[model samples]
Target: MEGLQLIATGGALPGRVVTNEDLSQLVDTSDEWITTRTGIRQRHFCAEGETAATLAVSAARQALERSGLQPEQIGCCVCATLSGAYATPSTACLVQKELGLAQDIPVLDVNAACSGFIYGAAVARGLLATRPQDDRRYALVIGCEQLSRLMDMTDRNTCVLFGDGAGAVLFEAVEGAEFAVDLGARGDMAIETPPCGPIRMDGRAVFRFAVDALPRTLHAVLDATHHTLDEVDWVVCHQANSRIIDHCVKKLEADSAKFYKNMDRHGNTSAASIPVALNELAETGRLQPGMRLACIGFGGGLTWGGMLITVKGSAV
Candidate 1:
């Protein structure tokens, strides 16, 4: 059996758009200062009544519809997020409830920071494999965050680097597909969240860790799949910073165009970044059938993960 099949992708962002100029009014930062460092021009903020669970459900609905599968057909639900509406009921459980997915299926949320979607997908695959053999076992994997609520808006450092969003991908277990994954953690606290306190991050430390982690995970996944960088159609890394991605592109001597960047538009949505970018690519018809993609993510927990997949389904 192929590792996992990507059936479709979906994403959601808050209605409120926060531009660099808008953030400048809140903090002692300028448009130039923010863009030069993070390459983020704008981001979204959840208005009242919009939570991480809401975004996750919305994204899941779209992906579920695109897959053309009834709610009862979904066998698993995995959500990746650092921010959830309620600590008790996980975001993935909420997706299952909102989407009316099967109650007997495994549904849970995982926190791997930005590397969540990769880890969640891996977890979903393993869980689905244990179920009764079926023609096509479908799983809904989502990454969502309402980091705006978790940040000290007055603190320009961490505040300016995040956005609120969610992304979801429908995965189906199919024969003859190709999927490989590599996951690791350094057990560092370069980024952390205190109990009932705003998020805290050592910018320099996390930045250093990310640059190193991205390439390591990328190579690990490629190696596990016995593939080369030259064969990759696109490299979707965590949308943390422009310099971090640019550095890797040059270091590996990979095609600059192959590295996709939407941080300029959405900033870092943590766990949601990679899948959100995937949804954008799919919606725009840029990600099509018969393509190979390498997705990498690095963030808090000092965690990192990479996955290589051969596209077998089209979004449109």
Candidate 2:
């Protein structure tokens, strides 16, 4: 299999910022109560006229600009989301139109919930492999979510845990770089959104699954790639909860500092969380060429996945 090289990354959050204090007005919760539990101080919520596709277009444009690749050079586009604007056109198609990408390329959306981004990456790698090598094929993978639309304002448990945003990355196929991925899902609704209703979850069950699944998935990917935790330059897990991340880090005996986090400000943007965190790291110059990164995601569909990738260039 041809390895995948991450060329550039970009992210976009909604303009409206909802702090814990703002949420407290809707729910009977205080800042200390929310922060101590979720490690989130504020989250972005979409206002009128802003949708997942719009946010994705914004992020994707930034990624394309940073990649120095024209929109026509993209051979495939994959979007990961659970809350998109339309159930028919697919958010990927909407993004393709918004970005003015070539019509010949494959464009589709994947719904693995929070694991959507990692799943989309795996799909892009497969799609890119099938393209002619001489064509200089590139894939655009995006994770976008309008999760606030699913929030129940009165239900603090689920309402305060989500936000709206999008994140994107450009990938090119290469040889010799190591790329290994693992994905799994249990056919149960431990966390889910009902038809025409807000999000619901068995918090205890979901928390237990995340802490156990995260480290196991990380180790599985590392074993497949023949690498160790110490060898990884950064570990970017889905920004769900700080406690979940802390537990997984402790279980693996990994350096907590190597784990990048931004949920304190962005909250949980569902599928967009990982890429959003990744873009932040890249923008701040924390990411560099040739570094090894382990990315993981877990959530709704009760899905979990991890990918081991080597940084391709200084662009991201």
What C-alpha RMSD separates each model from the true structure? 1.1, 1.0
Which pairs in model 2 have colliding backbones?
Answer: none
- Per-residue CA lDDT of model 1 for 1-316, tens digit only, reads 5478677998999999999999999999999999999999999999998998999989999998887888888889999999987887888888888888878899999999999999999999899889998643888899999999889999999899999999999888776677889999889878997645498899999878888889989999889888899989989999999999998888898899989999999999999999999999999999888799999999999899999987777964
Stretches of candidate 2 above 4 Å error?
none
- For model 1, which pairs clash? none
Regions of candidate 1 where Cα sits further than 4 Å from its true position = none
Task: Supply candidate 2's per-residue lDDT for 264.
Answer: 88
lDDT of each: 0.90, 0.90
TM-scores vs. true structure, each candidate? 0.98, 0.98
User: For residues 190-299, what per-residue lDDT tens digits would candidate 2 score against the true structure?
Assistant: 88786445999898999999998899999999999988899999999999999899988888888999999889898989899999988998999988998888999999
Of candidate 2, the 10-residue stretch with the lowest lDDT total is 128-137
Worst 10-residue lDDT window for candidate 1 reads 188-197
